[model samples]
Target: MTIRFAAVSACALLTLAACNRTQEPVAPASAAATPPVESPAIPAADPNALTAEGLGPVRIGMTRADLVKLWGEDSQPNAVGGPDPETCDEFHPAKAPADVMVMIQNGVLTRITLTRGATIKTDRGFGVGDSAMAIKQAYGGAIVAQPHKYQDAPAEDLFAWPHGGATTYVTDPAARGVRYEIGGDGKVMKVHAGDPSIQQVEGCL
Candidate 1:
């Protein structure tokens, strides 16, 4: 894949609540790829405001019943290749305005991904189509940029979450709770929320 495409996927995947242990994630290095020139203009988002903690009534630690009660029965309540397939339940919230996906692990919600032109934005006010530079400026140095696994660019991963404790001291990969996926063209394309599980790329293999 192109370096920018790889970065795009990583950022998008991470935001979709796919992540690793607390240690800063390292994107796989590209042996023969160049940096993306500029991010292209992506679709506008759904404008459903959300929090770093979650979107609307859904919170990170909520349960299946809670979701069912709030959203009724999910049309697809299972993601076969999810981090914990046996325990993971995926959903596409019917009443939501955006293209939303939620995953529950071990009976508690773990991730929420917005795609297909969902205009959801965090309480911080970042959303799809925003420039990486704009996001970096808005967060003001809190982001931990990671190399794209297959890209030659400097930062394919812009991360935000809580860390720095003996228990969480860089080992709880999920601590970097949110990711804003920037495409080769440099604009945000996807937004993800949840814990370390959000770091996942291709699903549990």
Candidate 2:
């Protein structure tokens, strides 16, 4: 025939160019589409940022942004009177002494009141059930106590005899002043001296 039909059309055009060079090279669907990578953003907390070693390690589920990252706002919400819970809100600290409250509620935190003389239980001078090493062996260092800041009670300090008379007749230790209320599980619910409702003693050690 015409040279076997032109050599069977040049071997069927070299088998369609070797089957399009073994196919499979078509990417470019936007180069196999790929675009997504971005994440970083989390910052917003400063309600009043507190401290006193951050209110001595507060506890109770903590939140209101962790009490504004440990107290910073200067705390102020107190509703009307006090005693907490109307949803709660009371945090005064102008230098301290609004009876030292800090209740919070929906935002978390429950209570904290280091008022009434600011804590000093007893350095041996006896009062809230006596026996601070037996009142430091019956008044050795000449006793003179300190610590005072009362509002609703609890958190006291005040010893006497810096030449004020009366060594320990049993009561009237100068008009008395030794409180130390620290509840919320931390312990020390109440010690007494004068007006924690007239001697509201409690455990100690």
Candidate 3:
């Protein structure tokens, strides 16, 4: 009788231990009831008449009249033999050299020439032979091109200065860099520092 009682007590204790071991743990109330966090609000940018960078405002497809309104008159036309009547051409006045060359056709702006000493700012990626409208689409305004001479292999080379009286397009005057050159033939000739001077044709009709 004593052995049976001891065995029954041992069996009861083992069952209790097994029950405790298999019980599920309770999660903290705080952790289970937590809410999601919200993000902070960002501030809006300031508006100004001039650009944030302090440069003047720029627009694309601006007409000759519109250009005159924005930049005033050109200092002087760069085209030799004075301005051409067949083509509308004007230079920004000395006070506002940024205007550069404004070319027009049938009273509509056709092309623009950026001289080496202008202040007009542009973002369009303009190259030589690009019409005024095309140039404005890529770059808003004209830029200066420094004085540079090309050295081609044959005297009859396309870029030979006098061949067509090359029109130098200054892409970044501040950097003293020229983007392209338009020959008299109205074709763009590559004029960079490389052998066989005329590298490739890059321009717009």
Candidate 1, 152: how far from true, in Å?
4.7
In order of appearance, the predictions have TM-scores of 0.64, 0.22, 0.37
lDDT of 1: 0.67
Candidate 1: stretches off by over 4 Å: 1-48, 76-84, 150-155, 162-176, 203-205
lDDT of 1 by residue, 1-205 (tens): 6999999998988886755536677998868977789888886643356555677777777787787787766655563536565576566766655577777778777778776587777767887878889888887767767655555553375677744212222346335367777777777767777777666653333
Query: lDDT tens digits, residues 35-60, model 3?
Result: 77978886543321111122233222
lDDT winner between candidates 2 and 3: 2
- Model 3 regions lying over 4 Å from their true place: 21-60, 76-87, 93-99, 117-179, 182-205
* Ranking 1 against 2 by TM-score, winner: 1
Best by lDDT: 1
Each model's lDDT = 0.67, 0.40, 0.36
Please give the ranking of all candidate structures by TM-score, highest first, separated by commas.
1, 3, 2
